[model samples]
Target: MSETADSLIEVLREQCLIQGQNGIKGLSVVFRAMDIDYSKRIVYEELKIALEKFGLLMSENYLRTLFNALDLNDSGGIDFCEFMHKLRPSLKQCRIDVINEAFEKLDVNKDEAIMIDDLQVIYSTNAKQHPKFISGEWTEEQVLRNFLDSIDTPGNPDGKVTREEFMNYYAGVSVTVDDDSYFDLMMRACYGLPIRGS
Candidate 1:
């Protein structure tokens, strides 16, 4: 296998392990029932497709539901506070993109934009709310703390998570996202649904 493919597999496996899905023997049992081969990428594609069938992509109902919740004034266009308020997530994605945008906004250093040190205690603040991952559970909090440490560092000597650096390592900037849509990456990955195409 190519190194890239192996890397992806390793990351996927680690994510499963970290998320408590790794040792979920029930996962194997369930896969067996579905006649799925866990070692196969096609299986992941199949699973992802199945999840899409269950609503991975945003339905009109989902958008309207979330939109109504955010439109506090009942007027079109989400205001600054309302935008931040509606941006929070009940669940956490082990990835970093939403936070990346937040960093872009808070990036005081125009030189490198946002650095890891720029982000601390990512709970609800007056300016922003993190929706992808709730700062919940002991390990989850640890993950946040570790993530902060991972990204924060001096520019030249220590070197931290610069906006560019963060995008390269964790955030996928090359993947142009859709604006009129409301869908999660986890759903996309698990279901192999192209954000734009299908």
Candidate 2:
């Protein structure tokens, strides 16, 4: 990881620190809401905090362990070839030719890869909707619930957005996400607009 990547990690570490000051016992919900399990997940945001908590950058093992998961072929080593092959589709879909600082900034949770949670956060934060992103006054549960509700899968009287539903549902309108307003994410989810950005 370079300086930009390190800065991305640092940002996430701070989020964990602020949320988990009471320790893991209290932080579990927030972590799950962010869609990461400490034991199995190895996202950049989580890893950044791990580096801080474990005093990363200073330790070789922590860095090694974080990237070790990318050794999908189990070759005992990871090279550029393998990484590019695996990440090409996602990178393309996300509209990135290379993973750079912008990608890091988009990854609010500090996880290297952007999951649905990360996107939802960015969508909500940038849209400036549902209060939490702007004010940071709600509980983790409240924030997650509000987002899920805002993006609830259509065709149900009560709003319910499951992982399967999120991927499978189609929105009725064409949405240009770069200029998407809060109404854009909200109405798209409610009306089932074809999702554009990740």
Candidate 3:
């Protein structure tokens, strides 16, 4: 990454850490507004306008360079995960371990990606603890689908989630949570994993 890009990422990361969930929410709103096509990926033109919208006036050269740096995949646009990852500080090793453990539990078939089938198996095993299932507002399938949708790549609900998507989703959540143990507990509780001492 260019120094400018790195600096910007640091600034954004610090701001989000200080503001917590509100900072993340504000960034989401900005991304949504900038994605004029609603494709969930910000193209060069869209990014240019977004910069201006935020009162940032950048020369054409600098803007292009920054955009290229953010587009890690060379896919010609920056997806929401990529954008957020750039702005969020790295998670601690403990947080990563817990996240991976939860992901492994969800990836029932040993596939690197979590699919609807995996969700079906896992959710069925834990359905009694699911609020939506207990309240009768959603069937087991509905609960699984909604959970998948919540974490799926933005604007591409393909009914599957890659590990990167899962990590990035939690990266956003990690900023909101200040403590590592709390995050671990949150994941364990949400996924019905046994508590640490148990």
Report lDDT (Cα) of residue 62, candidate 2.
48
Angstrom error of the Cα, residue 71, model 2: value is 47
Please report the candidate that would top TM-score against the real structure.
3
TM-score of each: 0.24, 0.21, 0.73
lDDT of 1 at 194: 47
lDDT of 1 by residue, 104-137 (tens): 5545455564433343333224113333344443
Q: State residue 23's C-alpha deviation in candidate 3, in Å.
A: 6.3
Query: Using alpha carbons, what is the TM-score of model 2?
Result: 0.21
TM-score of 1: 0.24
List per-prediction Cα lDDT, in the order shown.
0.37, 0.39, 0.77
Tens digits of per-residue lDDT, candidate 3, 8-43, equal 557555665576544554555667788877787999
Q: What residue runs in model 2 are displaced by over 4 Å at the alpha carbon?
A: 1-137, 154-160, 168-170, 173-198
Distance from true location, Cα of 100 in model 3, Å: 0.5
Which of the two, 1 or 2, has more TM-score? 1
Worst 10 residues of 2 by lDDT: 167-176
